[model samples]
Target: MPELAEPIVIVSDVHLSARSNWASKLDRIRGLWQKAGTVVFNGDTLNLGLANRKEMCRQAIECIGQICQADGVRAVVLAGNADSILDGPRHLLLKGGRLLVLHGDVLFDSISPWRRSAKKLRAARDESLRKMPPRMRASIEGQQASVTEAIRIVHDRSGKRIRSRRRTFLENLVSLSWPRQILSILRAWRDAPGLAVNFMETYSPQANCLVMGHIHRSGIWHIGDRSVISTEGFEGPRKPGVAYVEGDSVTLRIARQTGASYQPGKVIGRVAL
Candidate 1:
């Protein structure tokens, strides 16, 4: 495969559904795409539970396809926890594996039991779908609907409660002293940064930086020589964020909604890998 070009844009947790005005949102970031050589949907771009998965994915692809075609940029889509049942790239490796870009769900595998269980369920669903006859499986709409319903059942069972608890735990931990917070992250639920560090040490020891989305909080943290970067969710009230990767440097940019369009805001954080 051809290598991705510089000034790559990594967007995560878009959570686009049938009701979302995602095309307009994409228009707001048109400049970024126009400048970018490659644009990556880091993950969770489609919220499978909220709409028919096939339709949602189709819309997302069409929207992104237009932007890439217009801007002469390459587009890559990665699957996140919400859409893990889908078939697509799950992560991207950059700069000879020095930078790892993923959805950040792997970090939560050990932090939340529900997430781990849900992954297993997703695997089972993928397997079942694989076993279906070619003709039956050819109708992506039916298969996606079934997968979405399965995900909804899993989310209803434990995912919602797990998220609430995780959020509360993170908030309380952040309120503590820096040292205490580190200790809490090590002892209890690993925050995004902690989890990133752990994931790197265990799976990709050579990776110096991890750019991920899923936590819905945009920030940068350093652990020794390694760094972890997170972007804000694209759907929520929190400022929508995106990460700009240029070689070994990464910068986080949030968008400010102005009437019907959005303009890039301040550089919230920067890190050098």
Candidate 2:
């Protein structure tokens, strides 16, 4: 493997497929990749459920290969929940194991049935789809479609419930006692960062910083000396963000839409490892 250089840019949850307008977004990413010494794709570079998996994977690989061939640029690609069907490294250790980069899906494996099902489908499809007879392939595809539809229904209901609860919580927050408000805030904090902390403790305790993307929301949370940085996805209305690493410092750079193109805009957050 080639050694990655300093000032590495980490992006995740691209979710590239034939249906999405990802080519222009990728071109923007390529511009950023050219300026950085290394580029790390944190995961979900392809959406297996929404496209012809084999062809999408091939196209993704070809595009990434071109990026890697850029002068003085190195690429590290890791698999996410959607693209786990492909063979590649699932996680990376950097800065002598002080910093870890991962897709963040592992944290939800036990709690998210949708994620678990998707992972299983990817594995089964990858292992058998090509070798199976046409009838078997049709059967598997039918099952996958059913499962995906069920997941979509459940996800929609869950999202609505979550939004309602968030609104109720905010409305009640103003009337609550200071102690109760503090507790509510703490509980909210515990939801995502708690999962990240538990995951790191179990899998990569030596890591003081983690760069991950699975949840679309982007933010940073500090757990003592360990910090978790989550980046926004390319598919969302929110500007796509990257974690720019330089020596012991990491800065979050979100893309700014210029007149005709996107460019690295501002440092929204930073952390020292």
Regions of model 2 farther than 4 Å from truth: 20-23, 50-52, 111-190
Q: What digit string (tens of lDDT, one per residue) describes model 1 on residues 1-273?
A: 469987888888767766777777677666555578898888787776643367666767778788787888888888776766557567777888888888876565322223435455566456655777866555433344335444546666675676666557777767555674445444433467887887777667778899988766777888989998887665666787778888668888876667755566788888887
What is the overall TM-score of model 1 with all chains considered together?
0.70
RMSD of each: 9.6, 11.1
All candidates' TM-scores?
0.70, 0.69
Best by lDDT: 1
User: Where does candidate 1 stray beyond 4 Å?
Assistant: 50-52, 110-190
Clashes of 2: 0
Candidate 1 lDDT score relative to the true structure: 0.70
Q: lDDT of each structure?
A: 0.70, 0.67
Evaluate residue 205 in candidate 1 and report its C-alpha lDDT on the 0 to 100 scale: 78
